[model samples]
Target chain A: MLLRLSWLLALLLAALPARGAELRLLPPGLAYCDELAARFSRLPGARQDAARGLAAEGGRLCEAGHARAGVARLRRALRAAQGAPRLARSAHP
Target chain B: MPHTRRRQQHPGPLWRLLSSAGFRFALLFAVVFLAAGLAFAGVLWWGTAGTLERQTDSAIRADAMALAERGRDSGLAVLAEAVEERLALDAEGLSIYLLLDPSGRRLAGNLAALPPPRSGDSSWYRLNVEHEDTGPGEARLLVLDLPDGSKLAVGREVSEKGRLRALLTEGLAWAAGAALFFALLGAWLMRRALERRLTPAATTAALIAGGDLSQRVPLSLHDDEFDRLGASMNAMLDRIAHLMDGVRGVSDAIAHDLRTPIARARNGLEEALLSEADDPATLRGAIERGIADLDNVTRVFQAVLRIAEVEAGARRAAFAPLDLSLLLADAAELYGASAEARGQTLNTLWPESLPLVGDRDLLLQVVANLLDNAVKFTAPHGTIVLSAWREADWVVVRVADEGPGLSAQDRTRVGERFFRADSARTTPGSGLGLSLVRAVVQLHGGALWFEDAGGPPGQPGLAVLFRLPVAA
Candidate 1:
């Protein structure tokens, strides 16, 4: 009886659409966020703590299925990274 | 050795077209039009694209100024909030903004990074932005340092504007290509038109060169430029043919007239040489007759040369203003004795002064020849009249004699070299007298003709009249 109930539950779970499959329909802002994040990562600077924090938050949001909010934050992080000097510099100098 | 004939090489159609005046004119016209088109395109590009760029720059400048004022008044926090709000409102995602703290930390906006600093913080910069949806784009940016040790960047993506400019440039290129095509077509058509108009003249000329003197350029009733040109060419051909006929007639007459005298002289001399008896009187008589015949040939040659000289305008340099009346009186006085000796009454009527410009010797010779003909042709006791008068712009002279007038056919042939009326064939004079008179009168810009002198029935005398321009 227990084995039959377990098989029935497994079949029900298989019949429902998967979350990963649903997430495959990419949001409009996801590509933009990825572009901004990639650009920020390539920037050469020392004092990028604020940008790093924002980028981390944006990545968590995107992974949590909040793509629009993630893109907004990633854009702000990119703007912050732009303020950094081209050469490395001390954060509190 | 057999001679090999070389074939003539004619230019090809392309070569002819390239060398034609019509094609050159068309090319020049096309070049001028292209230059004008280029100038017009340049102006259009400057007016449209340039104005759009200027407006974009102005908008960027004004936006940066407004943002700077806001940042100054409301502090960094408010400025950052305003930038975020503005970016959220930009549905096209063309707006670009960046704010930086003193420590180079991201505060707000959409730019991936600050562009490398140029000369100063206040200066404008052009940046390439990588947009996810639209590929790479150009942005006009103004980066400014706030009073609180922060920086702000304000810009707008201008990819659409760049695309528009590219489209305009492409259109201009296409327009230029089309213009070139039409210009070449026009040149080809113009060349063909010119060739069509000129072909008749060229063919006629070729036929004439091949010895067909009767060939003439065909004409159209349109009377356009080409028709006028054909008419002129035809007129020229007619004149050439007429002159050629005259030359042929002169050659035939010379042969006929010269052969008789020469044959006569030769026969007389040969007879004298062959005589067995040594008769001095007969030999002397033959020699004298031969000398007279030779002298007659010499006179004919001299007369021919004089006519040619007059026709060539060689004696025009000797022309002078003089009283034609006096010249006529002189001629009458000189010929009067000959006329009287011939048993013909000589009479003169003249104006005291008939002004004219002419070569004096030629005019005197003309008068003398006319009087000589009159005196020779008039019957015994007949009347000969010499008269001169000024009429209108002309000085008129007439020599009338009581002799049989010329037939209409003879009148037309009178001035031709070696031509003579059948009635005057027995008269003692070369037929060249009237020819010389005609040449002299023509050279002096005068007209000469003949008419009946109005005598009793069966005595209709001849009147030879000439008129010279008073100024000539």
Candidate 2:
């Protein structure tokens, strides 16, 4: 009985590693999603409308338990909200 | 050895140049030029770089006002949108903009973050910014608080203006260097010209100091100031040389003329002393002859002293106004008896009044000397004419006789001290009479001349004429 108990403990340890690996593959947490939403809301100009639509879709996905997909959409929304004119653009032609 | 020592004592050319007036003037010129150039640079800086900076600040202020007005009339969101649009339109990326919410989070425009806030409602800030396109640079911004609790910042990068100012400063420095070089060159040239112009006079002075009295300063055809100075120096040197020659001539004449009378007087006395018989009559005669010879020598000395005194202007202080005609008449009357003794007719003619300023005794002596010469040289039964008159601004006196006139060469030399004419050599008088006459006339500012008396061909007599300036 003691031997069986040792085997069960090793199996449980293996299962915990698998779960941690799976969590690593998923998107970031709810805090990151909230930050991206704030950034998107602050964006200026007409290009922000498309980013607003993408953020709404990401919020719905997160509510439906597709956290990885929702996080991906939120990231795409933030990039779009940055708009056509960016700080990284060169001053000279 | 002295010449070598003098050469060694002279300074080098560089030292001379530094001490020269021309170099000093050049240094003054360079200093003035540098000051003027710096002043001009200051003005240019104000006109170009300073003006550009002011213009940039004005534009930034204008943009900030516009953004604030938009936020006031419409909303903070519209103001943010306007900032983004302006950043998109700026092709050179020189424009800078930042819109911040009340929480200090950047919402739009190119800037990543808002600058430090100040207490004022609106403020200007000069900040070092890391531009996304142009890297690090300076920016001038005007920050304004919007009505909706948002902030708008408008600015322009000023690195290009700084670069232009630096270029202008470098160019002005080069120009100043070139001007200094030219000023030094001009100073050296001016010193060379000054030394060249003065060399001739310096050399002549050196030669003269070494006992070469004939050396003179050379003149240039330019007839400039230096040439005029050289000419004046030459004239003074000539006058000095002439006076030296006159002194030598006077020495020779005194020795030659005085020796004869002294020797004769000595010989007569010696003969009397060496005689065989001790005779009183012979001794008295010899002694009397010796006295006469010594008296003649004394007379010559007295005449020389009188001439020297007159020439020295000693008699000028005793001058007073007197009628020259009256003086002449008195002299003629005194010498008339002498002319009568010689069987010569003495005739006098003069105006009633001939006023002039002179020494009366000296003028009388002048008339007496001419009349005596006339009486001595005139033939017996000849007419001796004495006349005086006023001619223009002068009192003229004339004495004419049927005597042998002087030759042309003797006329030029007549007034020289102890000079006697060949024709008058046998006469029993000193040759200082004409010289004394000349000295007295010159002292009184008068003129004297000898001319032909306009007599018969073989008897062209001498006429002594003189004129004194009329008294004012």
Candidate 3:
């Protein structure tokens, strides 16, 4: 019986993905995060840390299997990445 | 020619572009296009941004309701757990949540603190929550007062909407710039093409204005406006040249005709002064001859002025309807005695009452001139026929003379002022007789032409034919 229960558990685990093991199984949250990180890299060094932090959080949510929430987080990360350079330029100037 | 030479030193391309009409038109188009583009962009921004904002606000409200229901179903402990789960689920950090205790301490969610609650039932805030992580951004917050006096808040990031608006604005600006560049280029090309077509006419006009009367506008096979203008200008130039030649001829004839008479009078006076018989009859005879010579010169001048007045068209006011057949018969009758003395037979053909509108004196002079020329040029015993008849809308008059007819070349030039036929140069009288006749015919809106009156094969004499319009 214990062995049958362990097999059932294995089937359930297969049905519900553990996390970012299969990226295609999730939403486009991680892909969006990567795109935003690439854009932020072009900004000046003074504001790079804040942009990286936002992207890292978005990637974490995507890895944790919260796809819908992950997409929203990634969108926020992109906005932050886009806005950082302008804010840095203004603050420094 | 001098003007054309000056025009060849044209200004450079840049100067032409700045001064060209096409450039100004293109600039006007650019300004209008920019204004229209801005208006379109504004409408696009309003539509897209407004939709995005409304959607974002609704999502925020839904999130707030979900959390409030979660708290109502269980307690603050369960609500706080749900907030933690949501924060973990949201990898993008776009969702916001906060659970506050009765003393207002933030218990859960991504935000650092519970923002101060508002007085109204619902309100939106532009305040920044994750300032250290994502810089400043727009957020719509909804704070709900829990049954236990604690607070729950939810928000969604709205900075992406702003980014979209920025991208659209930048795109519109770039498009407007590209449109202006292309418009200016097209305008310059158009101006160049127009200038190429117009340059020839402008050059010809400049040359003509610079005292080159012989210059004429060039023509093309294409019957366009420019070609028509060239033809009209060429015709006008030809007329001016013809009139100039006429003036030159009249001046030469005046000098030649006056010199002989003046010289004869001077010689007679000198001879009388040198004579030893100082009698009054000899002096009176010399003075009388001089007076006659002066009178002849005076008559020539008077005839020239009369012809000029008729050609000026000022005698049209004196015109009235008169019977042309009667007028022809009267002229033939008046000259019949002279014709008989010269042993010439005068015949008349009349269509009873041929009517015309003209100056009576001028018409009489036309017939009289033709008759006088016939008498002067014809041999004795020649036949003269005077005829008047109506043909279509005109009254045709003919005074056919059996005289030595003129050549075709002489007939063409006979109506020019002071133009005398080569065969008749030795005859007495000024060469203005036929010219005055032509001027009178034209003033009456008629035509005067010469034809060979049919007679024997080799003796076809001149026919002076005139046609005048019958008045309504």
Candidate 4:
């Protein structure tokens, strides 16, 4: 029965829909960027520079008018920051 | 919740649209291609409108700043002429603009007047600016009092936003078309996949309906859901074939097995009927003969039922490991004595410790049946040999006799229930021996076959082979 269930899961996976690969980063403004960064304070402090680099990349992308790439990169940066130690300090503050 | 339930009861339009093959294929094709087209239109609109708006806003601001740097009255005159040129009534097309003072008077612009702001109006509005000269509606750009006190307005004959919106609407219509196209393509693929699956099923059903009981549906790669369906149908047909053959053969078997003793009983009864004295010994003989015939009939029915039960495999629970060598020895010894009395020599070759998994009674019966068949088939002065040994995975037993070997065609039908070889039609035994042998062998998950036991066929006979699985 467990084997049967696995087979069914495989078939279900085969039937899944394809989706566009896209990302959205620091909206059009700095305020939007800061608000998003605060939300993404989960990244480790050690990784914060990496996150910043990614955001810079996203900014570069947005400048190039590739908003999808920009958003994706920014989202990745925010996700990385979600684990930041500084977020714990600010949670109560 | 009720609405949800109702919705479930009544499938959505999208599902209905998806369910139809034509619609689904068209939809899939349309989704891919039309999405491409729609995405193209959207990007076109965004790029054109955004660039135009940015340029216009910058141009207007620069013009206003330049004018405000001059004296206010002179600037107003210059602005009027500039505004007139910049905001010339959009080719008499309503793509126009207006600059209004804080009091709602047009400071210097081509627009006739400013309509009161719609309720809860925001920073900017894309309004359908109308015109008496042009047709129904025209789009306009309106700017209010500037911080510098020089109201600025500039318009272009090209209505980018309006055109973009029109383009988007067109794109959506195109998207819907693309959706239909994609749906059709998907449905065509689905049908082929369905056909690949459905074809074997339809063929199998046709095969069955056409009376080919032995025919089977071939399994495909993956053994998918369709294969499951095929397997299920195959099982059903298997049962049907068994029953149809079983009923005809069973009835015939009952008759053949019963008739020998029945004829004996009739002969005895007729003698008693014709006798002058109703003698006690004569009556006893008649009654005994009748009883014997009835008993034989009962035995035949019991054998049939036992074979049926074994084939059903439900009695595998009663299965146990048994000594196969001992069973063969016993059959050979018993038959050895019987054959000796019948003027035939019995030979034996029993090996040690053939650890086999089988029902003791069934294994014993299999050995007994083989020995009995060899003894019955061979003539007087013939030698019957019974032997056993382990080979590969099976404990095989052989019972060969000095008798006439069955032809190839006859050998094939040897295990069929109630099938007696034409030469054996005059034999006094029921044809159920080898049939029962087959049933027992199958119950043990083994096989029975014939082999040329490499002896003189005249006095040392046809060989019968039985193989059973040896316990690991």
C-alpha lDDT values of all predictions = 0.79, 0.76, 0.73, 0.64
Q: What would the per-residue lDDT of candidate 3 be over residues B1-472, giving only the tens digit for each residue?
A: 3465544445798777767776666556655665566567557766876677677777776677777898899998999877755554344455666788888887776565655555776455555444442356655666778888888877766557667856865786697678767756766666666676667778988998899888888787888887888888889889999889889989999999888998988898888899887799989999899889988899899999999999999898999989987788789888888899999988999888887888988999999889988877777999998888888999888989887788899999998777888878888888888999999988877898889988676677899999888872
TM-score, each model? 0.73, 0.63, 0.62, 0.57
Q: Write the per-residue lDDT of candidate 3 for residues A6-39, one digit (tens) a residue.
A: 6754774485312211000112445544544554
RMSD of 3: 17.2
Candidate 2 — which pairs collide?
none
Model 3 segments more than 4 A misplaced: A1-93, B1-168, B205-212, B219-224
Badly placed stretches (over 4 Å) of model 2 are A1-93, B1-172, B276-288
Which stretches of model 4 miss by more than 4 angstroms?
A1-93, B1-122, B132-137, B140-246, B270-274, B343-346, B379-382, B457-460
The interface RMSD value for candidate 1 stands at: 17.3
State the lDDT at B295 in candidate 1. Answer: 92
Top candidate, metric lDDT: 1
Query: Over the true interface residues, superposed, what is the Cα RMSD of model 4?
Result: 23.5
Q: Give the per-residue lDDT digits (tens) of candidate 4, residues B1-472.
A: 3355433444688676556565555445545664465466557755865566565555544545544454255655565554543322112222244555545566555456554444664433344444333333333343445554645543333344456656765776677577656655666676567766678778878887898778777788888888888888889888988888878887877776677777887877787888887689878878888888878777777777787887888678877878887777777778888798889988888777788777888778888888887778878888888888889998888888877777789989888777888878887666778888898888888888887656665433588887888862
Q: What is the interface RMSD of each candidate, in Å?
A: 17.3, 18.2, 17.0, 23.5
Top DockQ hit? 3
Q: Worst 10-residue stretch by lDDT in candidate 1 chain B?
A: B84-93
Rank ordering of all candidates by lDDT, starting from the highest: 1, 2, 3, 4
Cα deviation of B466, candidate 2, in Å: 2.4
